[model samples]
Target chain A: MRLELKEVASGYGHRTLIRRISLVVTDGEVLCLLGPNGSGKTTLFKTILGLIRLQGGQILLDGEDISRWPRARLARVMGYIPQAHNPPFPYRVLDVVLMGRTAHLGPTAAPGREDMAVARRAINTLNISHLEDRIYTEISGGERQLVLIARALAQEPRLLIMDEATSALDFGNQLLVLSHIKRLAQMGLAIIMASHFPDHALLYASKVMLLKKGQVYSLGRPEEMVTEENLKSLYGVDVKIIRAELPGCNETRVCVPVCR
Target chain B: MAVARKQGSLTNSLATAEGNYRWREIALTALPLLVFLFSFPLGRYPISPGQLLTILAAKVFPIAPTWPATLETVVFQVRLPRMLAAMLVGAALATAGAAYQGMFKNPLVSPDILGASAGAGFGAALAIYFSLGVVGIQVSSFLFGLLAVGLTWALSSRIRHDPVLILVLAGILMGTLFSSGTSLIKYVADPYDKLPAITFWLMGSLAAIAPRDVWTALVPILVGTLPLYLLRWRLNVLSLGEEEARSLGLDTGRLRLIVILCSTLITAASVAISGMIGWVGLIIPHLARMLVGPNYRELLPAAILIGSAYLLLVDDLARVLTSVEIPLGILTSIIGAPFFLYLLLNARRGWV
Candidate 1:
C-alpha cells in the first residue's frame, strides 16, 4: 500500500489551517507527525482520512485518486485509532472490537460468525483476548487504548492512522504500545501517527514530518529530521539530544529539555 | 502460539456468554406472553382461569359454548384490545427511546426529546377546543407531532456548529414552544368541557382504545421498529460519538436522520392512540439494558419484551386497583420515578 499526498490543503469550512503538505508512506513504514498544538497536525490527519473535505490538491492510494471515494471504501483501506474516551453505554470489549466490521457489513446487516472471527483475531493480535468479555468502561486507560488499537486492526486496513494514541498512557505502557506499533509495521502495515514526544518518534518512526505554522517545516528520516534545533524552533524551548549507551542495550537517542 | 491458545479460551468464554444471552432472550420472550395470559383473569368481570382458557380455545377448537355471551364480550372486546394496545404503545415508546438515547449519546434522553409528545399534546388540545371528533383529534395529533420534530430537525440543520448539541438545544426550544402552545390552548378552552378534556388527554390514558386503535398503531410501529431493528448494530457504533462513528465508515448524518424520523413516527402514532403515555419510553430501555447489557442486538429485543410486559402489568393495576381508572401517564410516573432513582444510585452497575 502506498499513500501519497500532493500539495494537500484542508481546514474547517472556508478557513485554511494547513496547506502545501506533501508526504508519502508505503507498506512496512511508520511516519510520525510532530507539531505543537493548533499547528494543523489534526487538520492534516482529518484531511487524509477524508473526515473533512480537501480544500486543494489530491490524495492518492497506489497512484489512484481517493479524494472522491466513499467513506466506507476509504475506511476499508485506512483504519483509525482515536484517543481513548468513554462512551455512554457499557459495551463489552469484544462488542467494541466488532464495531470495526461496520464498513465491511452491508447497510442493514449485523456482524456474523465470520465477522466475529475477524474481531477475535484482532483482539488476539493485541494480546487482550482475556479482556474480550469484560465491560469496556470498566477497563483501565492503557487497556482501553489497546482495545482501540485492536478495533482499528479489525478494520483489516493496510494503512493505519493514530491520533496521539499513547498520549494518555503511563511511561511503561507508552513504550509497550509503541513496541506493538513497531511490530505491526514489521508485518507490512503502513502507519501514520501524530505524537507529542520527539523521543517516541525517534524510537519508532521510520520517517518523521515536522509541522510548524500550518506548513511542513521538514520531512525525512527521523535521525535527520528530529534535531535539537528543530525542537527548539518548533516549541520555542531549549532542549538537548543525547545518545546514551546502557549495558546490554544498543545506543539510543533521548531528548532532554534544559531548565533555565 | 500463546496468543492462539488464549484465543481458544476466549472463544470458550464467548460461547458461555452466548449461552447465557440466549437464555436471557428466551426469558424475555416469555415474559410478555405470560403477562398477557395472566392478565385475562384479573379484570373487573372476574373470569376464572378455566373460563379464560375455555373462551380463548373456543375460537380455535370445536368446543360448545359453556360460558355466557357477555363473558365472550368482556374477553374479546374489553380486555383483548386494551391489553394489545398497552403492549403496542409500551413497545413502541421504549424502542423509540432506546434509539434516541443511542443517537443522542445520552442515556438520559427519552423518545420525546425532540418535542413529539408536546407537539401531539398541543394538537389534541387544539382539536378539542374546536370540538373535533375522535378521528380528527387523532389525525391532528399525529400530524402535529411529526411537524414539531420536522421543525426541530430543520432548525438544527441550518446551524453548522456542533450537530448533536445544536439538535438537542433546538429540540428543547421546540418542546418549550409547543408546550406553551398547549398551555395557551388550555387557557382559552371552555372551562366546563374543553379544559378537562384537554387536561385528561395530556395526562394520557388507554381507556378508550378500541380494536381499531390497535390496528391503527400497529402499522407505523412496525414500520418504525423494523428499520431500527435492522440498524441496531449501527446504533452501537453511533453511540461511540459522531467522529468515531464517521471514521468507522458510517454516514452519521444519514443514520441520525433515519433514527429521528423513525422514532418520531412511532412516538406520534403511540401518542395519537394512547395519549401522552410517559415514562415507558424513558425508563423501559434502561430496565432492558440492566437485564441484557447494552448491545443493541439484544437490547432492542429485550426492551420490546420487557416494555410490553411492564405496561401490560401497569395497565392491569390501573384497571383494578381503584374504582376510578388511573391514567397510565400518572401510574408510569409514580412507578418510574422511584425505579429511576434506584437506577441512578446503582448506575455504575448498568451504565457508564
Candidate 2:
C-alpha cells in the first residue's frame, strides 16, 4: 500500500493549521514525523486519517483519492493507534483487540470465532498473548501501548498510523516498542508515526519529515534529515548529535540536549 | 515459544474464569423468574405457595378450583399485572441506564441524565393539573420525555468543542429546567385533588398498574431494548470515547443517535407508566457491573435481569412491610443511595 498527500491543507473548522504538506509512504517503510508542540503534527495526522475535513488538496491511497470515502472503508485500508489512555470501563485485553474487527463485521455482529482467532494472532505477534485476559486498565503503561498496537494490527490493514505511541513509555520499553514497529515495517506494513525524539527517527525511521509551523521543514532520508541544524531550528533548542558504535552493532546517532 | 507456553497456561485460567462467568449469567437469567414466583405468595391476600402454583397451573390445565374465586382475581387481575409492570419498568430503566453510561463513557451516568424522567414528571403534572385521564397522562409524559432529550441533543450539536462535556451539560440544564416546570405546576394545582395526585405519581408506584398499563409499556420497552441488545458489542467500542471509536470505523454520530433514541424510548415508556422512579436506573447498572465485568454483551443482560428482580423484590417489600404501601421511588432511593455510597468507598478497581 502507498499513501500520498499532495499539498494537503487541514485544521479545525475553517482555520488551516497545516498547509502545503506533501509526502509519500509506501509499504515496508517507516515515515517519522517530528515536530515541536503545536507544530500541527496531530492535526496533519487527523487529516490523513480523515478525522477532519480536508481543507485543501488530495490524499490518495494507492493513487485513489479517498477524501470522500466512508470511514469504514478508510479503516479497512488503514489502522490508527492513538496514545494509550485508560477508557472508563475495564475491558479485557482480548476484548480491546477484538474491537478492531468492527470494520470487518456487520454493524450488529459481535466478534465470532474467526475474529477472536485474528485478535489472538495479533496479540501473539506482539508477544503479549499472555495479557489477553488481563484488564486493560490494570496493565502497565508500556504493555498497554503494545496492546493498542496489537489492536491496530488486528484490523488487518495495509497501513498503520501511530501518534506518539511510545512517548509515555520508559527508555527500555520505548526501544522495545520501536523495535517491534521496525520489525512490522520490515514485514511489509507501511507505518507513519509522530515522534518527539530525533534519536528514534535515526534508529527506526526510514524517512524523516521535520514539521515546523504547520509545513514540512525538511523531508529526506533519516541520516540526512535528522541533522543538528534542523533539530535546533525545529525545537528552538541546541543539541549535540553524537555518533556511537556499540559492540557487534552498526554505528548509531544519539541526540543529547546541550544545557546552558 | 516460552511466550506461547505462558499464554497456554493463562488460557486455562481464563477458561475457568469464562466457566464461572457462564454460571453467573445463568443465575442472573433465572433471577427474575424466581423473584416473580416467590412474590406471588407474599401479598396481603393469604395465598400459600402451593395454592399459588395450583392457581397459576390451573390456567394451562383443567383442574378443579380448590381455592376461592377471589384468590384468582388477586393472582391474575392484581398481582400478575403489578409484578409484570415492576419487572418491565425495572428492565427498561436499567437497560437504558447501562446504554447511557456506555455512550457517555461515564460510570455515574443514568438513564434520566438526559432529563427523560424530569420531562415525564412535568408532563404528568401538567396532565393532572388539566384533569387529563390516566391514558392522557401517560401519552403526554412519554412525548415530553422524548422532547427533553431531543432538545438536549439539538442544543449540544450546535457547540463544536468537547462534544461529550457539552452534551452532559445540556442534559443537566434540561433536567433542571423540566424539574422546575414540574414544581411550578405542582404549586398551582388544586391542593385537594390534583396536588396529591401529582405528588403520589411523582413519588412513583405500581399499586395502580393494570393489565392495560403493562401492555402499553411492554411494546415500547421491547422496541427500545431490541436495538440495544443487538448493538451491545458496539457499546464497548463507544465506551473508548468518541474519537477512538470513530477511528475504529464506527460512525459515532449514528451510534450516538441510535443509543439516545432507544434509551429515551425505554426511559420515557418506563416513566410514563411508573411515574418518577429514581435510583433504579442510576444504581442497577452498577450492581450488574459488580456481577459481570463492563463488557456490554454481559453487562446489559445482567443489568436487565438484576434490575427486574430488584424492583420486584422492592415492590414485594412495599406490599408486605406495612398495611399502607410505600412509594417505590422513595424505597429505591432509600435503598439505592447508601448502596451507592458503599460502592464508591469500596470500589477497588476503577468503575467496575
Candidate 3:
C-alpha cells in the first residue's frame, strides 16, 4: 500500500501548524522524516492518523481517501507507536501487547489461543520475550520502547507509523530499534518514522523527507537528502560528516554538528 | 506469523485457566449469598432454616403451605426488609465504586468522591430538621443527592479540557461545601431532639427501611446498574485511557457521560435507602480487583456479589454481637480503613 498526502494542511483550530504538506510512503520501504525540535513532526503524524482535522487537501491510502476511514479500521491498517505513552496502571507486558489485537477480536470475544500466540511471537522476534510477565511500568526506558514496538508489530499492520519512538532511548537501544525497524521494512511493511537523528536516517532509511517548520524542505534518497547544506539549513548548524566503513554497508558515516 | 501463533496459544491457555478460575469465583460468590439467606432465619426469631426456606418457597410457588408462629411475621415484616435493604445498598455502592474506578482509570477513586455522600447527608439532615415523614425524606434524599452530583458535574465541566483534574477538584470543593451546609443545619436544629436525629441519620442505618422505600430506591439502582453491566467491555477500553478508547472507535465522550450518570444515580439511590454508608464503596471494589484480575467483565459482577455478602455479614455482627445496634457506617470504617491500608502495602505487586 502507498500513502499519499497531497497538499494536506492541518493544525489546531485556527492555528495552522502544517500547511500544504505533501509526501508519499510506498510499500516495502522506510521513509524517515528528519526535523529539528519544534518542527511539527508530531503534528504531521496526528494529522495523518486523523486525530487532527485537515484544513485542506486529502490523504490517500492506496487509491481511497483515508479521512473517512473509522479509527478502528485505521488502527488495524496502520500501526501507530506514539513516542512513549505511559499507561496509568501497571499492566503486564503481555497485556499491553494484546491490546494490538483489538481490531481482530470481537466485542465479547475473550483472547483466544490465537491472540496469545501472536503476542508471544512478537515479543520473541523483538528479543524481549523474557519481559512478557514483567510489569510494563517496571521496565527500563529502552526495554519499554522495544515492548511498545513489539506491540505495534503484533497488530500485523500493513503500514507502521512511529512518532519519535526512539527519542528517549539510549544510543545502543536506538541502534537496535532502528535495525529492527529496517528489518521490518525488508519484510515488506511500509514504515514512516520521525526522528531527530540524521545518522539514523542516513543509515537505515531508503527514502528521507526533511521537514523544517512543518513544511517538506526536501525529499529523496537518504544519500542525496542528508547533505551538509540541508542539515545546516534545517538545524542552523555546521556539521562535519565523515565517511567510514561499517560491517556490511558502505552507507556508514558519522555526523558531528559543531554549534556556531 | 510466528507472533500470531504465540498469541494464539497464550490466549487459549488463559481461556481454559479462566474457565477454571471462573467456577471458583462463582463458588466464592455463592457461599456469601447462602450464608446471608440462612442468617435471616437464625435471628431472634427462632424460625428453623428449613421452615424459613419453606415459607419463602411458598411465597413464590404456593400449592399448600403451613404457617409458623407470630414471630415468623416479625421476621418477614421487620427484619427481612432491613436486611435486603442493607445488602442491596451495599451492592449498589460497590458496583458504582468499581465503575468510577474503571472510568477514571484510578483505583483510588470512588463514587463518594463526587460529593454524593455529603450531599445525601445534608439532605437527610435537612429532612430531619423539617420533621419530614418517610416519603418526604426519600424525596429530599433523592433531590439533594442529585443536586450535589449535578453541581460537581457542572464545576468539572468548566475545565473540560482536563477532566481528571477538574473532576478531583470539583469533588473536593463540593464535598467541603455540602459538609459545611450540613454542619450549619446541625447547629440550627433543636439540640435536644433534632440534633440526635440528624446525627443518627448521618451515621447511617438500614434499620428503618420500609417496603415502599425499598421499591423506590431499588428501581433507580437496577435501572442505572443494568446499563453498566451491559457496557462492561466499553468500560475496559475506557480503563486504557480516553485517547486510546477514542482511537478504538468508541465514542468516549458519550460513554463517559453515561457512566457518570449511572454511577451518580446508583450512589444517590443507595444513600437514600441507607443514610450514608462509606468504606464499602471505596474498599470493596479494590478487594474484588485483587481477587480477580482487572478485567471489568469479571471484576464488576464479583464486586457486586462480594459487597452484598459483606454488608450482610457486617450487619449481622452489628446486631448479634451487642444489644445496641451500632451505626453501619462506624462499623464499616473501623474494619475497612485498616483493611484498605493492609491491601495498599501488601497488594501493590498485583495492582496496576
Candidate 4:
C-alpha cells in the first residue's frame, strides 16, 4: 500500500522517452534518483505525478491504481516541489504557501482560518517563519528553495516529489535542507527526490536508484552501489570515494571527483 | 522568536495594510456620492442641492412634488444618466484592466489584450457608414467586439504553445485587422458627416449619454464583474503562470477562459456606450496596485472605487472647465500619462 511504478512508459505524442521503468517507494523512506541530463529523469517524475499520461503499466498508490486519478484528488495524496520559480507578481511568502491548501478548499471558496493555520504551521516547521511576510521574488535563491519545500509541506501529502530540491541552495542551506528531508522521512512521508549530488544520497537517502539512458542502471543501498567505479561509468568523470571525519558531523563517506 | 506573533493568520497584516488607508477608502467611496450629489444642480439647469434631493426622492417614492417640472427633467433625464454612464464605464474598464494584468501576468496588458476596443470601434464605424441609429450602432459595436475576441481565442487555441504568448499574438493580429477595417470605412465615408462622427465617437465623450445607454451597459457590467469580484483570490494563483498554477491543482484552462469571457464582456459594453476612453483601463489598475498591494482581494475593489471616482471627476471637468467640451479620450491620456510617468520616475516600490 505504497507508491509503486511497474513497467511504466510515458512520453509526448508518438515519441516514447521513458520505457519500462519500475520502482517502489514506501513510507519513512527516501529514494534519491541520480541521473545525467537526457536520461528522462523529468519525464519519469512527470509521469508519476500524473502531469502527463502514462502510456503503459500501472501506478499504484496505496494499492489503488492512480494513473488516471483526478488532479484534485492527486493533489491531496501527492505534492510536487518544483525548482525555484520567480513569479511575475511579488506575492508574499505566506500567500504562496497558503496556495498549497487548494485541494482542501472549494473552487470559489477563499482559504479560511483553518487553512491559514495549516500554512503557518508549515512555515514554522521549516524555521523560516521570519520570511512569511517578505516578497517571494526578492528573496535569495536558497530561501526560495526552502519556501517551495515549505509550501509542499503545507499540502500534507502522503508522498512528496521534489525536483532538484537542494541544487540552488548555499552550502549551509544545503545541509539544513538535507536534514529537513531526513526529518520529513522520520515523520513517515515517502519522498522521491532527483539530485545531482550522490553525496546527498549517501548522507540522507535510504535507497538510491541510478538511472542511465532512460533505464535503471543500479538500485540498492548507497554504500553498496555508489562505488568509485560506478560513478565514473555513470558521469564519464573519474571519481574517488573517501571516508572523512569533520567537526560537528559524523564520520561519513564522501564522493570526490578526481581532477585530470 | 519574533516570527510567531500573537496574530492568528495572514489577514492580520492584510488588516494592517487596509488600516493604512481605512479613511482613504472611505473618502474614495464617498467621492462618488459627493460627485453624484453636487453634479445634479451644477449643470446649465442650475437646480439647488435641496431641490435635487427633493426631485430625486419624488422620483423614487410617491412624495409631494415640490420641485419645478423642468428641474425634475434635468435631474432625471440628463444629469442622472450621464453621471451613471461615466461612473459605470470608468469602473468597468478599471476592473477589467486589473483582471487582464493579473491573468496575463504582465502589468502592461489592459482589457484590450483581446482586441475589444478596436473591434468595437470598427463595428461603430461600419454602423455609421450604414447610417444606423444610436441604439443600432451601440449594439453592432458590442457584438463585433465579442466577435474579434472570439476569433483571437479560436486562433490561439489551435497553436497550443505558451498560452499567454499565443493569445497575445492572435490579439495583435485581430486588432490590426479590425482597426484597418475601421480606417478603410473612414476613408470611404462622406468627409463632412461620417468622418467627423467617427472621429468624435473615437475621441470619446460622456456629453450625450442617455438613460437607455446606461441601462444597456449596466446589466453586462454588473453580470461580468460579479464573478471576478467573488473569485478574485483565484487570480493570485493564476498570476503564478500556467505550469505552477496547474501543479497547485488549479484548472488553468477553465479559469483563464472565464476571466477572458467576463473581461471581454465589460470592455465591449463600456466601449459601446462611451467610445474609446483609452487610459482608464490601463492606468487606473496601476494606480490601484500602488495604493494597495498586489493582493487581488483588495486590488480589484480598489481599482473599481478609484476608477469610478477618477473618471467622474474627469467627466465633470469636461463639462464645465471649457466652453467647448474636450473629449475624454484626449483628456485621459493628457492626465494619465504624466501621472503614470511620475510614478515610474519617483517609484519607491517596484510595481511588479
**Docking class for candidate 1:** medium
The digit string of per-residue lDDT tens for model 2 on A99-166 reads: 99988888889999999999999999999977988999999999999999999998999999999999
lDDT (10s digit) by residue, model 1, range B1-352: 9999988997898799899978987889999999998887887789999998888899999999988999999888888999999999999999999999999899999999999999999899999999998888898999999999999999999998889999999999999999999999999999999999999998889888888889988999899999999999899999998889988989899999999999999999999988988888889999888888898998999899999999999999899999899998999999999998888888765462
lDDT of 2: 0.92
Best by DockQ: 2
What clash pairs does model 4 have?
Answer: none
Query: True interface contacts reproduced by each model, as a fraction?
Result: 0.80, 0.79, 0.24, 0.40
Q: First chain of model 2: TM-score? A: 0.98
lDDT of 2 at B22: 82
What DockQ does each listed candidate score?
0.70, 0.82, 0.34, 0.56
Error of 2 at A250 (Å): 2.7
Question: By descending lDDT, how would the candidates be arranged?
Answer: 1, 2, 4, 3
What is the overall TM-score of model 4 with all chains considered together? 0.93
lDDT of 2 at A68: 84
lDDT of 4 by residue, A1-260 (tens): 39999999888876888888998999999999998888888889988888778889899987799966766788888888988877767778998999888777788787889999999999988899999989888898888888988888888898889888788788998888889989999989999999999898899999999988888888989888888888988998988889988899877888997886
What tens-digit string does per-residue lDDT give for candidate 2 at B167-195?
Answer: 89999999999999999999999999999
Query: Which parts of model 1 have CA positions greater than 4 angstroms off?
Result: A246-250, B1-16, B62-66, B348-352
